[model samples]
Structures are given as structure tokens and as C-alpha cells.
Target: MRFSSTVAFPLAANLLPPLASAIRISPAPNGALLLRDSYDYIVVGAGIGGLVVANRLTEDPSVSVLVIEAGDLDDRGEDVSIPGSVGFEDPRRYEVKLTMTEQEFLDNKTRTVSQGKAVGGGTIVNGLVWTRGSTANFDAWERLGNPGWGWSGLLPYFRKSETYSTRDHDISACKIPVPVHPVNGKHGDQGPVEVGYPNYYYNQSDNFLDGVQQLGIPVNEDPNSGNATGATVVPSSMTQKNQSRSDARTAYLDPALGRDNLHLVTNHTVTHILHNSSGNAIASRDTPIVNVTGVEFASNVTGTMMNVTCDKEVILAAGAILSPVLLQISGIGPAQHLKDLGVNVAVDLPGVGSNFQDHPTLQPVYKYTAPDVFSVQDIVGATRDAVREEYLANRTGPWTTPMVNAVAFPALSWVTDNFRELLDEAVNTTSNLPSSYDSTLRAGYAAQKNETLCFLSRTDTPTYELMSTSWGQLAVSAMQPFSRGTVLARSSSIFDNTQPIVDPRYCSNSIDCKLLLLGIKFNDHLIATSPMAALMPVPPPGFGTADARNETSLDETMRAMITTGFHFSGTTSMLPQNLGGVVDPSLRVYGTANLRVVDAGVIPLLPGAHTQATVYAIAEKAADIIKAGSSDAFPGAKS
Candidate 1:
């Protein structure tokens, strides 16, 4: 499997429909008919991670696997299947939006965080961009405490998750040349997920590149080739057969549903992970360590709590936001926080909900004065009706990709001339962690800060990203955010009727804002340059000015426009237990046997890339670990 990198590459010419999903495993309203009393393994949250694990574990046929999901199967046709039908499709049909706790840094404004509400998880609604940030991003995971979790160690599994395609296909239906990435050996050929270039490349790709190259930033050509510091065209996870969205369900789960060994129960939220008790409803304090035995779930339709047993293990693939909340509610989080929430402490892991990180984006939309060029802006604005009709009728055109066709990943040095000063200020500040953080969390933040500082000083690793959409909108995200936050549970019971307090603490570190503002400065210059100047003639508001904006004005813009790239991770980090880590290198919950987290939550650090592709890779690697009996395979395992 290969993930191509791009800052702002075009998507056109290489297109196909979708693989036949005639045999989908519909969501079982109740597990009574589909589930067993005790399966070899129980996977919670039938999202990317759980589905991959279930499909692989059941391959033995000798063992049975059960999957529990909180949402129903995706039934929204185009919204769930189309490649670039993100904002244009039914927005919230398959997603559950959580109102995050008011961000103190963002002027006490609460943002809505939307997660996939269906069985397929976030894959059901995320942007179809598939990429891995850089080699430094994954290598940092190994530096945090995990062995064989680095870039080289994980690339094989990344290759094992997707079938990368580079061959040209018919593009005449839409009357365009097929756009494709180079077929390097770094990609895979026979995998579940489909990885390939879209069928329509935006004409402005070369123009943007020319304008950027004038600034001395070289083209990376491939963002996933261990270097993600330049502009390039990225690949999307779409089926080569029909040019439809290829997600966890369409790629991995749908094809394996006929196997009797695998069972899935959707529309059921796993409230708590049942464990070996000290003969009590809540395990006694004396028995701090326990093994998971089963799970207690509440039905979405009935709201009734039910239990199912598992003979081997319980894997949490609920995602970064929910996984840590699950651990806290399951008596396995920070002991003090659990006690305050009236929950018994099974494992006093302080890191269960700490180290929360995400890519904080600043979305600034710029309207073009004219739509004369060959960019998505030109195609969508000039011939909107005709292009949409062509895409829906023939499955080709600019509609196959989201409006955002190109991206720019520049190191701090390229972003701003004051890099040394920012690094110095960051290094001298000592701590950028949240106030409520525990000592162990501070230790972890310190380690992460050092890694971030290293990334900031480097010229090849991108610390910020700049992307442009078809609508003349520009979005930038701080790639390696220094600030850390927490995901605190509201109560011990899942029936609390409240979402967890997800405080990403965006822009808490002053340095993050500086980086984003610098990114804006870089984009401002590029838009005014020769080739891009003709495409998008107007300068963005509060940008592209001869005079630099003041700190106060920039701060106001950041506070008003800040949002997420939806690339969340690091709540239940994989690191040393003593360093505020929830899961060990083997992805197991510390101090608990037979319980593991196989999702984005365990990623110790947020990767510079979109999370979907990396999540697929992590899930693939985790399946291998679970099947090998983690304890015996990785002796340095913390759990």
C-alpha cells in the first residue's frame, strides 16, 4: 500500500466507478441473533481499526470474532460513496457532531467536532485525501517508547492495507487526460483499501507550482516518500473500478461479511469494558490490575444495556476522542479523576486521557475576481452545471476530487525568517502543557516538545501546511503543535447524556499561531506572484499586503477563524507507562491484560498527514501484534 503526498496537486483523468457492495453486512440492531456467548476476540467500535482486526482475525476460521459499533451502517448513497462529495453532499447524515468544551485560547468559543456516526467510523465522512506526513513523524513514535513502531517498521503494514494503482484508465467520458502518480515499489498491489490518483487534474496545478518554485521551494513530487516538505499531487482512497469512495467498509469489511466466523453488531455503544472483578460491581482498590472479560453495550434503538463475553481480548477502535473516554468510564484512567467521577480505578494510568493533540486549521476563504483559468475554481464556477452532470453521469471530471486540489508543506525556515527566535522562545518557555496536567503528563510533554523543536529546526520536515480549494479558499494547519490538552470524562456512566470535555487547547502555545501566520504570509506572496496571480487575481483579506499585519490583528483573525483539520489523535498515547502513556508499544492498556487500543488514539504524536491512511496502517500492524500474543512477541511491552 502506498500513500502519495501532495500540497496542491490536481485530481483528474484516472477514474473508475465503485466495487460491487451488493453483499454488505447490515447493522444488526441487536446482537441476540448475530453474536455469540464468547468469541475468541471482541472488537469495540466497528470502524477502521476494529473491522481490519476482525477481518484478519477471522481468517483463521478456527477462531470467532465479534465487533460492536455505536452507529448504524452507512446508507446515504453519494455522500458515503463519492470521492469529492464532502461538503456538497448530505453534511451530517452519517456523522455525530460533538460540541467541544469552549477553547480558552479561542476566546471561549466552543467548536463542533464531528465523528463518523455509522459503523464505518470517520472513514464514512472524512476527506478522501490519502497520505503519510513524513518519516520523522512515525519515527517519533518509536522514540517515545515503542519498538518497531517507526516509519520503516510500519511501512510494510501500510503497504499491506491498500492496493496502490498507477495505471492509466479511460478519461474520455469526461474528456480529460488521466492523472496518475508514479508506480514506485513503495506502494502495494493487492490490498483491501484502494489507493490511486483521481481522473481529473486541475489546470492550475502547474501554475501554482511555478509560482511556488519562484520562492525557491522545490517540488517533493511524492509527499509519502519519507519527505513531506514540498508541494505535490496526492492520491485519494477511491476504487479503481468505479471511481467511488473506498473506505474501511467498502474495502475491508464488506468483502469479509459472508464469513460465518466474523459477527458484527452495530447501533450499539459499548458503555464499559467488563473486566475480572473482585467479586464486586466495581473492582476494589486492592486489585488495581485486571483483565478484560467482556463488554457492556447500550442499544441505540432501545437504550438497553447488554453484555457479551470474549475469551481472548477486547480491542478499542472507537477513535481518539471516544477511546480515552471509554477507558476513563471503564475504571482505567487517572485514579484521581476516576474517583472524582465516582468510578472505581482499575488502572491508574494518567495518560489515558492526556496528551491530546490535533492539527488546528485556520480557514480563510478568498473569492476570485474572475474565473477564467483551468483551476477547480474555473471549472466549478464557470461550468458548474455541466461538470456536475458529467461527473454524476459518467463518473469523471473535477467533481471526482474535493475543491482543494493542491497543498504546500514548508519547513519553518521557508515559512518565516524568524525560525531561530521561535525555537528559542519555545525551548526557553519550558512548558506549554495544560494547567490540570499531572506530573507524568508534564514529563511526556517535555519529551514531545524536544521532538517538536527538532522538527521545527529541520528544513525537510514540514511544521505547517497550506492548502487551497476550488472556491479560492486557503486553509493552514500547524503540523507539529506544541500545546497539549486532555479528554476528561463527565461521569462514570455512559448514560450521562454528555460528550466528554475534549479540550484540544488549540493555539495554547503562542508558537503555533506564529507558524500559521507565517504560512499565511507565504500563501499571500504566492497568490500575488506571476502564474497564480492570473488564476486568483484578488488578494485575500488581511493578507498579501505590502505592510505586515500587527500582532493584535493577526491574533484576532486566528481566534475568529481557527478550526480543526479533523486530524485528531494522541489521547491514549503509545509510550512508556511511566511517561504518561496509556498503551504500551504492543497497543495494550497498561496494567490491564487482554485489553488493547487499536486506533488513532494510541498514536503518541499526531502525524503531519491526514489520519485515515495512517489509521489503516496502524490497524493492520495491530492485528498482527494481537494475533502473535503481544506479551510474548514484544518483551519490552509495558502492559
Candidate 2:
């Protein structure tokens, strides 16, 4: 049955001792506090995943959940709550930047990879796009042996965690729609999470959608229905009337914050997962013992190390990059890599830090000769002051805008069936399969064979995969990318000067490069289309004839301008241990039982849309599995 409201489990009171004595809670030590000396569940990194898991698990009174957030909660006024304040260039919402160095990807020079280290994780400082991948994509995962990961299996959780706010008349007047799936009974009605259309929109947004439609792309009513193959104006995680942005903290934490069983510790960093010498049976054991529990954290202000312990499980929700690094530091990654840095290997799971993937985006901006829609600069000065006054007075203004007002999915023709056949043949012929080919590869090969032989009827066409085509002078990104990358820690020490290496290997695969280039070309084609061209009389800056020429080769230009889509996945990938996967289908690391990863890091492959909604779904499903004794909840026979 449905456990949405009837599940009235109380949190374990014995787990939380006071913040004063349980652990040291001091701001002088970077304003970090030890709210609980021991908890049944110690979730590391207060990102979307951690917050969801903690919030869900705490519903049970018997389970004491402690969420240690490295960064402080949003105290910078209501600027973060504003709707129009979203964009890559917006600096008011994001203050603390957790920087990483990626030398292998960007011109082989160290580049800073910044992520929000605060309460809501990237949700507080992200595009706030609410989209999901294609059902076909998830079906492919199940076909590859991950049984429960299929779209059908996961759709329930997606609906359960969502509370769609679609009744606002202003949104309808703006032409923004919330398309719901026919079989959406599983969705919550009065849930705390708010999902709705943003109130404000650029006039060009409508023109942009019409332009793409004229260029042969169909308009989709609901992009989140698992078939993201058309252009449409998708919704965001925001309030309907006020138009204020709703972050993960607002959706998951704020409603449940008053629960005494749920304890939140800010300014605390989790260094590693503590394990006992039970050796390797740790994962399967029902009662795993902790030798001596402790967490390694530093002051957000001064960057100093602090150690704290947990009475039970240490859950790692440190996103795709930091999660794997934390595992390696805890001696759970490649045995050879850990030995090189003088750290004792706890678990010899070679896949702990392998199978990394990310969506690399290239935006070819078009300069609008006409006074384009309101630009970020337009809202500054007196406009900014007025918006600030409005926000302070009523919590509404341009400051509440999400990064992108609209998003659409378009398919690229290059990475179609023919391309897959060629890649499959090449992979089969290559004797050296990088020693990383495990179940995922075998499953991919098997799926390829079936596709080639039967010519399966699938909605997601490689020739036209999912691309986030939208209005404005820009397109969000292509939903699914064939390119694969990796995230590696430079040293075992959590405090190592070296940054965690992230090589997106963007456009490294010819198919991915072609898809990106095609997407850019298609976007340009849409702008030139009759219906849209009439409205968008002028294009945004960076779109010109010289750049759009057929002979110009948009591939080169895309490679030069492409940036990380920020949808990082597959680092601590979920696959069979033998297949170079760190976590199993249940999301528990192969060699460790008491420890588990509940974040984007375990995503076997990138979803076809934005990761925020998918991440929330993953966390919701993970909580269910964890609550249902872990064995009978997920794919594969439970360990």
C-alpha cells in the first residue's frame, strides 16, 4: 500500500544527545556544531540526496537521523528566495564555492569546478529546471540487468515526491503549463514539496518555442512524463503566486524541521566512513559494527579539521565528485590508488571512483538587435532596488527568476541506430576494453544486439535524442549525451592540495561531438523558422551568419565554448561489483554493508533531463528501500 501519510514512525530519541555535550558545536571552530554524539543514520553532505534521505528516514521514530551540512543555511536575506535571480552569472544566491581542479578536461590546465557547499546543495544554486529522462532510457537500464531502475519501476517515486502547484491563473496567462501524466495517482496532493510554473517569463520565451516548432520540432505538454523528445516550456521548483524559488531545503527540510527526532548539524564536514575489521562481509551483515566512529570536517571559515563519530551507519551524499573521493579516503576505492597515497585500503572495490559521466553543454548566444527581453543588467540599479523592495515587502520580484525561464528537448540525428551499431562493433573488436567493462558493458552489448536484430520500436531516437531547446537567446542543453567521463581524487588525504580530477572527456567520443554540434545547428534553424523568427526579430549576442555557415563546422565552435552541464553522474556508478561498479543496485558499496551512497554518484547513467527532479526521486526510492529492510526494495536479489 501507499505509505505517504499513514507512515507515522517516530525518530529514535536516544540517538540525539544535546548539541552542547554530545559533540562540540562552536562557531569559533567555523560555527560547526555536534548536535548528536551518535545517530542511527549519519548523512554526510547536506545536498539534495542527503536531505531527502534524512527527511525520509527520520519519519520513523526508531531511527535517529543526523544531517551534517558543511555550509551554513541561507541567511543572506530573501535574495535567494527570489524567482528571477537565477542564472549562471547570478552571484547573490551562491556565496560559498567548493572548488575542484579538472586538469584532464579543459586544455589540460587546472580549472576550478565550483559546487554549492551549503544546506540545499546545488538546489540553492542551480538552474531549478524540473525535468526527467525518457522512459526508454530507464528501460534500457533494466534491459542492461538493473531490473528495478526501469521507468515503470521508478515512476511511482517520481510522482510521490512531487506536489505540483498548477492552479495559479497568472501562470496560465503567461502560457506556462503543467502537463500531468494520465496515470499520476501516485503523486502527492498536499505534500510539502512545491512544483509549479514560474510567474515571470520573457516575451521571447513564447517566440522561441514557436520558432522551434516551425523548424519541425513538436511541442510537448509535459516534458517530465519520461518522453523528453520535444520542445516545451517546462516548470521549475518555485511557488506559484509569489514566484519565489523553492529549493530542496524548502521542499524537504523546512516542513520537517520542527520534528525533534530530526537533527541538523551545520558547518560540519564528513571526511570518511568509519568501518570495522569484519573485513568484507560488511555489506551483507545485518548487524555491522563500527570499530570507532568519527567524521572529518573543517571550518567553512578557516578550513580546519574536526572529527566526530556516529553510533551506526554513515551515509555519503556528497554528490558525484566528493562522494567517490570520500570513499577512496575511507580506503574503499582502487587498491593501487589508495596504496600510492599511504592510505590503508579498507575495501578493494576498483569501481569506487570509476565510470564517471557528465553532460557538457555549449550555448551559442544570439545578439538581439531589438531590445531583447529583460537582461540581468536590466534588473540592476533602480530596477534591482525596486525588485528588492518588492521582495522584502511581498517576497516577489525579478530576483526570484530561475536560471532559465523555459526549457525544451530536441533530438540530434547523428547518434542514432547506425552510430550505435558502428560503436558496438568497434567495442567488440577492441581487445582492450579498459579493464572496466563489467555488467554495464555486457548489458549495453546485449541491448545493442537486440536493437540491431529486432529493430525495436523506441520513442527516443538516437538520430533525434533529447536536447533542452527553449526560448530566450539560449538553449538549456541536450538531455542525453553519448560522451562519458571520470572523477578521480588526486590523493587519499581529504585535505590534499590537489583537486579532485574531473575529466568529462566532452566530445571525446565522435558521436557525442556530432550530437552537440547538431543540437546547436538545430537551435539556429529554429530561430530562423517563420513563426518564431517573426517574434524574435533579433537574435541574442553570439549568433551570427559567420558562425552558422554550413562550412563553418559548429563542432569546433562548440568544443571551444562548451561547459559542464552540471548534471554529474556515474562516478560511484551502480552496477555489479565485477563490472567495475562501486555500488550495487541497492546503492550499497560492494564491499561495505553498513555504508551506502544515496546521491547522484550512484546514477549508472545520466538521465535525459535535469538531475534535480531525478535526484529527489532517487532519494525517495532509496529511503523506501532502506525502510523496507533493503533486501526486497530495489533491483536484483537483495544481498
- Candidate 2 residue-wise lDDT at 620: 79
* Tens-digit lDDT string for candidate 2 (1-639): 000011111222321213221222345454445456667787888788898888888878778887777676764234345545454333433434434344233344333355776778888767667777678766765665566888877887787677776645543444343243423443445554577766445655666666666665676776666667666666678776666667777777776755767777776566666666444332222343334365666643356666666666677898888898888777777767777766776666666666666666665555444544455546656886786666556544445556564555655432243545644543444222234445544454334335322222344532233332222346435455555555667776665623676666665445455556666656667667775565454444344445667434545455556666777887787765544566666677666656778888887766667788888878877888777766446632110
Could you tell me which 10 consecutive residues in candidate 1 have the lowest summed lDDT? 1-10
Error at 129, model 2, angstroms: 0.7
In the range 1-639, model 1's lDDT, one tens digit per residue, is 111122121233333233223322343675344446788898998889998998888889898888887777766375466665655545446667788888887778898867777767888777778888788988988898788888888888778888887535554533212223553755777889997666665656656666777787777766777788877667778876566788888677778756788877776788899986442222222233687899998775357677889888899998888888888888888778888998877767788888988888887765555556554434444386687667777777776765554677878888677889988987886456776677878888888888888888887788877776655666788888887778888888765634778888887887777777787777778887787777755655555464346756766766767887788888889878667888877788777767899988988988787888898888888888887884436322111
CA lDDT, every prediction? 0.74, 0.61
- Tell me the number of clashing residue pairs for each predicted model: 24, 33
RMSD of 2: 7.8
